[model samples]
Target: MAAAARLAWVDATSGVAGDMLLGALIDAGASLPAIRAAVESVIPAAVALSVDEVSRAGLRAARLRVEPLIESPPHRTWRSIRALIEDAELPEPVRDRALAVFGRLAQAEGRVHGVSADEVHFHEVGAWDSIADVVGVCAALHSLGISRLSASAVALGSGRVRTAHGEIPVPVPAVLELSAGWQVVSGGAGELATPTGLALVTALASECGALPPMSLESTGVGAGTRDTPGRPNVVRVVVGTPVAEGGRDELVLEANVDDLDPRLWPGVLAALLAEGASDAWLVPILMKKGRPAHTLCVLAPVERAAALREAMFRETSTIGVRETAVRKTALERTWVHVPLLGATVPVKVAHRDGEILQATPEFDDVAALARKLGMPVRTVLEAAVAAAVDQHLIPGAELP
Candidate 1:
């Protein structure tokens, strides 16, 4: 199980780039030697990786530089880059992340030019430094054990910027395509999220909103090139242990219908859950003119609000839906296998500050075990709890 210590929140308050991300990780205390060695294993020997402590707009940060001693084309095919990473002697997690970043770039390019991912030739990112930026950042995060990632909405810049495809508008075609469903805004008259940075952020982030509850560990600021007039050109990474379980903000959507059939509720709820709803249920209510109805409600991550809404509309009979942003706090969760009824059942264990707070068997699985063993569901559940207690899953916590 490759897992991070907790959470890493990247504040793209100013903007993000591959070098900036790697610099931030280095600034936050990831070993430069380790990152260099990992990146060197995949890239050319002449490409040197270095991190220097630099200040932008009076704020200090780490700057990552990749100096390729040999002259090379500023491009590589998606297949070539993928092969390089696959052949690199990097950790599994690092290799996987680097692949994901490049893979996203390939997909973006393919989408922009109507070509296949493997056939797409990376332009700006085909350069040696971009490879270093992608792989080095992965190595740095893996070295720091920052598994789960999140980010604030990225700042987009306006005006025209030159690219391998010639002078194009800022927030280039690929960058916009990569951020299709994400939060983005124009804050300046220049590029903020580069193609490399956007793909890196989009690839790894599981959630994008406010930072979750976590014990503060370390912070690194990666400085971008050129300063903006109103803000420092920097990307900050915050590393920390999750303060509690299943944390962060969520969105709640509601739709009330008086004309739909009652029999479809279960399937509708299931569809929402399958589409990434945290929880979905229905509340019976009275609509206008004494009409009876059920209010279908679901809680989902902010990003899934759109998907959830589509599911609701497609699966249910409702003309409109209401969405409300909500904060949801939850314990970090783990699972332990417990022997029960001569077989094994999974016990869900929830914790706070590393202390077990609740241990319960999955009711459905317990019920299945009960049917198989010809016993009551209660018997299976109780046996599972006893197994947890005997294993000391949560010492000093009461058990049923």
Candidate 2:
């Protein structure tokens, strides 16, 4: 059996920064030496990383500092940074995640400055320390084997911060652009969430909410530079195995349409799914004055509700959408390949509490194999089911 997937829930209630997140991951048991090596592989001899036990408010936390070894780090364009990361000798997953974070930053900066992403020159983020922080965070996540990442609503501070461009208001344009779909609030004064930090969360985190249900394993507190008296200037990361029985928080968006053509419903449903709806369907109903209509219902994660709602408006003629919070409980699912009729057919297994509840062959795969073998689709499906049963994939059986 495959190992259970681990979840990392980032508590950024105080605030989040790249360095702070990296520190939290390190304190949570990620190898500092591995992170250092990954960063050095990309930007060799440019910076050094070190961590110290520090106090934030009354709480003890890890503070990671990136010290630049060079006199002056060059302000690099997005193109240059992309080349450096792409050419580096690093693990595939780590390299891919690092590139994603930087890509988000580049796009945000480009949109804010009215320039193309490739031509955008990073200022504060172009420094060696910032690069080290981004790469180190990705490396740490890879080292810790974090399969799923979620975060709480981010705290974007108030007031103004001086930047290479000028003194800008807190939650700068780039940060605001990146935070479009996610929730945010002003947790304190001054700039609490930097652009790099926002990019890390928005680009990498799959969902945003309060702490999720998990079997607690370890907690790491990463301290920022300030040690405020009343509030802890830190980001906390809780790592654990997800609770299978717990239901995930979700939202339902409904829209009633009476005038749309029946042929368009298919396209609208497809568009909603593309916009992040987990499941979307239509229910036929009779409306006022005996008018027939279809009620469109969409299921979506909380973080994706906004975009999916907008998609509904754009794709359909509905002027308003109603939303309701919901809880979704799902069985653990996995896929296995079964040999049938000289072809491999994939079977989806759904299980609960270590017992398989159902095993279904992928119809599309069965049909494709049938076409290739010049056999009936029904025959191919039966063979596939027989193959799965032969492999002990059935109800009440132990999950493979």
Q: Pick the candidate with the highest TM-score.
A: 2
> Considering summed lDDT, which 10 consecutive residues are worst modelled in model 1?
302-311
Model 2 scores a TM of 0.68
Report the Cα lDDT for residue 197, model 1: 95
For residue 214, what is the lDDT in candidate 1?
79
List ranges where model 1 is wrong by over 4 Å: 1-3, 246-400
Pairs that collide in candidate 1 are: 4-147, 214-243, 245-330, 245-331, 245-332
Local accuracy of candidate 1 as per-residue lDDT tens digits, 1-400: 2344556899986878999988998888788998989988988585888777778888988877888878865578999998998898988778767876787688788879999778898878888889889989888887888756788898878889988789999889999988865788786778988999998887767556887777888999998888655588999999887764554666778888898888888888888898889999999999899999999999977545544665675688774566665678887788888887689888888887667788888888899999998898887788888888888887446332
Q: Evaluate model 2: give its lDDT.
A: 0.86
**lDDT (Cα atoms) of all candidates against the true structure:** 0.81, 0.86
Clashing pairs in 2: none
Weakest 10 consecutive residues of candidate 2 by summed lDDT: 302-311
Cα lDDT tens digits for candidate 2, 225-258: 9888899999999988778645876778888999
